[model samples]
Target: MKIKSLSLAIISATALLSGAVQAYETGDIIVRGGLASVNPDVDSGNIYAGGVEQADQRVDVNNDTQMGLSLTYMVQDNIGIELLAATPFSHNLQGKGGLAGLNDFAEVKHLPPTLTVQYYPMDNSSAFQPYVGVGLNYTIFFSEKFINGADATFGSLELDDSLGLAAQVGFDYEIAENWSLNAAVWYMDIDTTGTFKNANGTGDYKIDVSLDPWVYMAGVAYRF
Candidate 1:
C-alpha cells in the first residue's frame, strides 16, 4: 500500500511541473499594451510644378510615438493571428536640401492597422517563444496642418493614404503562468503623394514621398 501511495505521489508531482511550463495554448487570447514608435526612412522626390520638376526642393518627416495595442488569438499552439493597433500618430514635416532649416512646415495625424499571421517556433512547454510574421498594413492620414503660422504660404495639405506589405520578428518571455514580456519590431512599406498649392500661385506642387517606417514595441502581455 505504501509503494502504491508513493507511485501516486510521483505522478501528481510530474503533472504539476508539466502544467507550470505551458505558456500559450490553442484557443488562448492574448492582449498586450505599451508604447510604440514609428520612425520613417523617407525617400522624397523633388517638387513638381504643373508636371515640371523643380530642383532643390524636397520634403522630410520626423517620427512619433503613441500607445500601442496588440491582440492575438491562438489557432494552434504554434500559430496565431494578431492585430496591431494604436492611437493616431502625429508627425512633423520639414524641408530638406535647398529647403533646409525649415522646421514644422507641416503636421499630420495617421493610424495604421496591421494584421499578421505569426508562427511561434517553440512548443507550449517553453517559457521563451520567438515568432516571425508576415502581414499587411493600411495607413490613413488626416488632419493635415501646414504650420509656421503662415497658412497663406501653402494651401491645403493633402497626403494620400497607403496600403503596403509588412514583416515582423518578435519574442515573448514568460514571467508567470499567465503573463509574459514581449518585444517586437516591424518594417512596413508606406508611400504617399503630397500635393499643395504654392502661395505664390505657381500652380500646384506634388511630391512623391516614400515613408517606409520601422516600428518598435515593448510591452507586457496577458493570456486569458
Candidate 2:
C-alpha cells in the first residue's frame, strides 16, 4: 500500500513539472476569440447648420459589444506581432446638452481593425503571461442613416473614416498545454467630422466628433 501511495505522489509531481516546462517559443502562432465591448469617451462639437452654430447642441454615441478575434505570431520568446479584428459594431447617435430633448438622430456602423507589437514581461515558461501593446487603429464607418424622420429633415448624412493610435494592457493564463484564458483593455484615439444637408432649406450641417473609446475583451486563446 505504501509503494502504491508513493507512485501516485510521483505521478502528480511529474505532471506538474511537465506543465511548468510548457513555453511560448519563437514561431508560435496564437489565436484568440471572445466578446469585446467598445465604450466611447466622447467629445462632441456643437451643431452648425448653414455655418450658423447652434449653442450647446452636441452629438454623443452609445456603447456596443461584438465578437472579437485576434491573431498573434511570436517573433521572439518575449515579443509578438498581433492583429485584432471583429464584426461590425453599431452605435446610436444622440443629441446632448441643448439638444438633449430630441429623439435619436441617427445610427452608424463601424469596424476598427488594429495592429500592434506586444511585449510580454513574464518568463516564456510561466503559465501567467502579462503583456503591453502599442500600435495603430483604422476605423471604417458605414451604413450611417438618420432615424425618426430625421432623414426627411436632414437629407443625406456622411461620417468620415479615421486612423489613429491605440494602446493596450492584457494578461493570459494557461489552463492547459495549448489553451489559455485572456482579458485585455485597450484605449483608442478616433476622430471624425460629419456633414449633412438640411432638406428643408439650402443649409449644410456639420459636426466634429471625437470618439476616443476604451475597449475591453475577455476570451480564450489557443496556441499552435
Best by lDDT: 2
Candidate 1 per-residue lDDT, tens place, 1-224, comes to 99999999999998997787778889999998889999999999999988899898898899999999999999999999999999999998888987787766888999999999999989888888899999999999999878886466887678999999999999988888888999999999999999888666557878999999999999998999
* Model 1 TM-score on a 0 to 1 scale: 0.91
Scored by CA lDDT, what does every candidate get?
0.90, 0.92
What local lDDT score does residue 105 receive in model 2, on the 0 to 100 scale? 82
Local accuracy of candidate 2 as per-residue lDDT tens digits, 1-224? 99999999999998888676576789999998999999999999998888899999998899999999999999999999999999999999998999787658899999999999999988887888999999999999999888876788776788999999999999889998789999999999999999888766567899999999999999999999
Worst 10 residues of 1 by lDDT: 149-158
**Model 2 clashes, total count:** 0
Residue 54 local lDDT, model 1: 85
Lowest-lDDT window of 10 residues in candidate 2? Answer: 16-25
Looking at model 1, the pairs that clash are none
